[model samples]
Target: MTETAEQAVQFVAMARKSFPALSSMRGSGGPAAAAVRSAAPMASHFLRRRGEDLLMKAVQVETEAGLANVREIAKVEGLDMVFFAPVELAASAPRGQEAGLLLALETAEAEVKRAKKLLGGMLVPGRSAEMMFAAGYDLVCTTSDVILVRAAAENIVREAKPPATGPKGGLVRFVTSGREAKFARNDETLVTRLKKSRQARALGALVRLGSAAAAELVAASGFEVVVLDHSRGAEDLLGAVALVHAASRAGAHSLMRVPALSQAHLRRALQVGVEGIILPGVESAEEAHALVELCLYPSRNLRDDSHAAEARLKNQPFRRMDFSFAPPLVEFYGQRVAEFSRRQGEALLIAAQVDSPEGAAHIREIVKVEGIDMIFVDAMRLSGADVERIETAAKKHHRLLGGLLVPGCHVEDMYRAGYKLVCAASDHGLLAEGAKACLKAERPVE
Candidate 1:
């Protein structure tokens, strides 16, 4: 049988085993539950290899000791691992602006290079475009908090110029500054001063541009996966789509975040052909089932048949729908949901948006959902006290917890807290800004 057909058959079998009770839960819940049970096995079968081959086996390393800990985890996790190295080690400087920051950037870049050479590929959080592009890391995660910084860096780079020429056309002077520095002849005081000032204002712009450029470069260099950190709105969808298209063109994999899993947003994202969906705020099995149902071809809700036909004609997969649910409730309903998703042959992801004091308890319950393939933690909702609790719970359960944040949050902070995936809000400028941010976030840092 063809791979797709074989997958469908496997899904049916797994559904039967996972949700025997699905037959009894008649009504809206019944079908959804059955679908998930059915789909889980098939989804698992397809995803297992991909997860093993492409998913970054991220490790949180704060120091050399932490690196050692990560190495141990890699061994236990099997082969082809990627570590999310600490941002402080990779981005922060020990002292002033003179050499410390530069040293830090270089160190971070070297560390990533070393890891990629040793581990085959790894994920890393980066501050500068140079570090991110130079390191050759597999994936790079960005936080909403740093958008301004990114924009600044891009602007600086854009304004930079080659060394100026003297009256006789000899080289005049070279300005060595951040990534934005420009070169000009000593005689061209007026132009250099204006350029320097302009560069200062464009610092944030420069960073943003650099981030995007870095993503393009990474894809061109032949990375396997690119994930974007988008937490707020749908603005990042286009950027995500662009990255996906670019990566696909480059023969790489691309993934992005849909701030939430609404039907409209999910459809739009799927239309763009994103390989994965990072749904935030999922808390229950029923919700998980609902998401799976949405991912299926016939979808729980009716869709325009014409659109499906068109997608097929264009060689595009039909868009999958997604559902969101709060916690505690998913625990009781996840199995049914998994069954329904399996029967339908769709992709489903469970997002754990831990915003309340009871989030840890809720996550503990969520981990038990038999067919849940992935888990996302809404860090924006999670308080400082809840970080360790949630991390420990997710780890013990062997569930993947993605980190999410609003604009201005730190990717390193989330990584340090044990979040392998980081999503940031996409709304800042236009809807396209969010879209672009999503794509850039997903691009591997290397």
Candidate 2:
């Protein structure tokens, strides 16, 4: 067996001792486990059987107290990453607080960068590709809000700009009332104007291009590690893949966000070569532990030749070898899931969504799980103060904490509090534009 695989087995064995509950879940007589053993080779089966060993603890924090608490946990228990919630721009620039907001964001970025430099490793919120580029965040998470905002921003810009000028002797010059924008020689203002008039119909096309641009920005920024927010549906997966492909082409790493910790989504994401899986709504350590198992090992319990063939057919050259499997769907599923849990040992990062006080309470136990790597508090559902309280409590329990930012959340406050990785929903295009803007601002003027 490979050293990594062997190491995985050892970790699983150790984990079994610490997390007996996981063993119970994989009941001794469970047909799924037995089926994997009977079908796959003994070595593969052993690796698969040792799935639970690779779990790690992670959490989400959204307040200064929470940040301090997370720092305390990191010092004591080796916390993984601190994801700040809602790393986004304020709607309308926060009415007279734009400077303050910008300063806060800059400060947060500086703090996160400092932590990474000093602490060896750190995760930060990258709602847009520009944010990721500007901050050099380790993890970039795209959100729907950012996407929509970017699209709107792009449309406004496109509409605001006058159209291209056609050939001198060709189409008539069409100009919008706003300052007769001058174009360079050979520019096609007429064509540009026509394109702008048809903007409504071309919104889809623009968004797609924008999405690709965002992914490209993330890729070019040298922050290749990105986690796409895919909690919405399977359709979002395609967009995430597109972004990954674009990012990869530009020299970045990409991970897909799964709807939840289900085998189906995990299987699909893996098939596409997503570097990691972002699981939502994970309420317990058992669930987190199970997710880690699924990510590392192949699922030996499921089988389907058609699926294997399909994966092979759509293969990309940039795909990772970790996902290069051809076993029957059932067997592959069991093997991957089991192997992932056993060998990787908590390396499988999870962004559990906590929307309620009850869920917040459950986070403590979830962090205690041997394999859970991160916890992402959902700001859309939890108040900032409540999230802070949870982080404080979690710190007392020696758990790492993170926070999530949605449409109307106070992300800056979360950053100040010490939450590291903030996410917007899934809007790849917006992320690209934002990244581009950030890049432009940082570049030296000619």
Candidate 3:
């Protein structure tokens, strides 16, 4: 044989040796081709699972018998994702909970053949079906088993007694801070899916973005909340307005962590549609009080414009609108027109971060301040003693206590430490980790 032919033969041998599974999957034609075509939408569904978006609604099936229940569950509108649970456990669920357990295997749009196409295989143990479901929501949000058990737990909770704190809806929220990206771009396919996921995960994570185009993808990829961090020098506060719009489109609970405690910054953030503010370096009750008042729409302003037209603050001189006259407000106005104080009107949330020793000393006083919903201790900055101090104050005041997700620490540990809300590492960190993981994956034999 010629040298080139010998090299080609070696390459073919290596390719066959590397892709043993591909040989089994070689005949993915006819029915499989049709399955791939039909499952394209399912592929998009997995990618679109955004942080602020709704958890893609799913129902469970355990056995062939469960297929009979599938059509019944599909009746629930907007129900898309489907997972399979262990029959022994799922059989115990009561009727009300059953609505959430059953999923459609065949429907007006889907036949059993089409449903099989989406999953590609039955979700038995060690099957890829389970993995497909895990990727249904945020990879960090949960695993496939958690979804199955949560449903069963909810059923048990409902049967035994009423929930201790209602249905923990929107309780397990994640907040991710944005890092300055020198070159931040995501896959065009992923960007498209992120847009799709926004509509569903609209209520997920709070995030900060560095720029608009690429950073907007950060907002889209399930971390819908825009965290306008101090370090992200995006021209001015005005630039953050577009970030807020992107977050809004994603249906995120937008929360900004400002550079400094400026009334102008607070006003601009709120006007653009920030649902919450994370006040950093909070020290005293006086600071907490100022943060609350400025965070609120002026009660007096509603009575009449008078001096309200001038949106000027003590040192800040720019005159701009204070309240959010954006689409959310516009929708509210369309429903009913009324002038009322924000004390009774607005649903905005205010969070104070205790990062300094002075803040620790005044934690009790700060918690006493009304209008605030959470007390965040900067666990990354403070000592263990400081976190306990802030946590005690938070529990005493019935306010949610939050902190950063410490490296190498389990989220369960943070919860046990009495931290209800935990901010994850920066987006850049996650991206770096992902890149490292991708590089670490073994390639096919050469």
Candidate 4:
């Protein structure tokens, strides 16, 4: 059996084995026979992604501990910038310099808005910068900034000591059990959108998660996407699974940038409830076609004949998929996987990363591959002409285009350049940027 065929036998064995204790008991809604103060009147509006409206969070005062508190805020993990807001000048145009105030405000506001319109990577854990990137970026009127600063001020104190006892405890309790990531807590996966609106492009902020806390934080930060950066390989499979659970519970969509395209990696990525996979380093049309087959099972309306592939996969032996789990559990998982793969194209986002000219040269063929929903290109690679050629091909084939939110580029610029998806820098980059901002914010103003 080929690797994919061999692994197919384990599909049903791949049903996530976690979180059955409480999950097996579905809530038909109430906490009991009575309505309580803790219950809301409506279903939660939390979604797989946030809307297109721009968001800005401002840090007004760190009055708790003076410069020490200020420095504390600066060191937060993903905090990106310490924008020097010249409130005195932007607000108080002295009688003689009223006209000049307009110029000062324009220059200051422009300088204050951070670069790249971060994809919700603004606040990690540190205080290097007073403010973190929220979502959309635009010119805020002086009055609006002041109002926004005040609104965000409440969160500075509130998030300082958020409710600690909920999902964090849930992580410890269920993370080891291998919970099913799809339809977590009864919240539908983003895959449902395939059935509803295939033409709706993926838009809005995406935060890469490294921990359960990060997952909750990203979701609460209002980002629509919670991403796991598995480009380092599958060394952290358990950790990635935990993030998926946390992201699902916290109400965000999870996707992964995988290191390779092996059947084991792709199968596990899906079984774990990742909504999408961005596979890196593709150089040929055959590789792209293989990616589709490995990812999309055998859809008759889509890629290949489903019945034959199913039979081949079912009869194959895949020790890789059925390692040390109990026999009964493995049997159950295989069944679930078989069921999932049949309809996975509706939920899974398959992307190909074309970084070299070899891949770019085959852009038309790659974009024509049936199962891929998106194609990601490394902006730092390829000449401008190559990028444009890929862009044209991708659009012509009706594929969504994605790219790096590289420095010297804004999120809007990527959108204008015909990219529907734009990824920001990694958490490491955000952390380092935040750390620098902390130092800059702490320096005594001259």
Show where candidate 4 strays beyond 4 Å: 1-209, 233-235, 297-338
On TM-score, the candidate that comes out on top is 4
Among these predictions, the greatest lDDT belongs to 4
TM-score of each: 0.33, 0.38, 0.44, 0.50
The reply for model 1, stretches above 4 Å from the true place, is 1-215, 218-225, 228-240, 249-252, 283-285, 297-361, 404-419, 422-446
For candidate 1, write residues 19-103 as lDDT tens digits.
Answer: 3233344452565655776877454445444544453333333333333234233333232333343332221112122123334
Error of 1 at 328 (Å): 28
Query: How many clashing residue pairs appear in each of the predictions shown?
Result: 75, 85, 19, 28
Compared with the true structure, what per-residue lDDT tens digits does model 3 show for residues 301-395?
22133234223222121111122122222222212112323222344557898888889989999999876667876766677788788888888
Worst 10 residues of 3 by lDDT: 182-191
Candidate 3: lDDT of 230? 53
Model 2 has a clash total of: 85
> How many times do residue backbones clash in model 4?
28
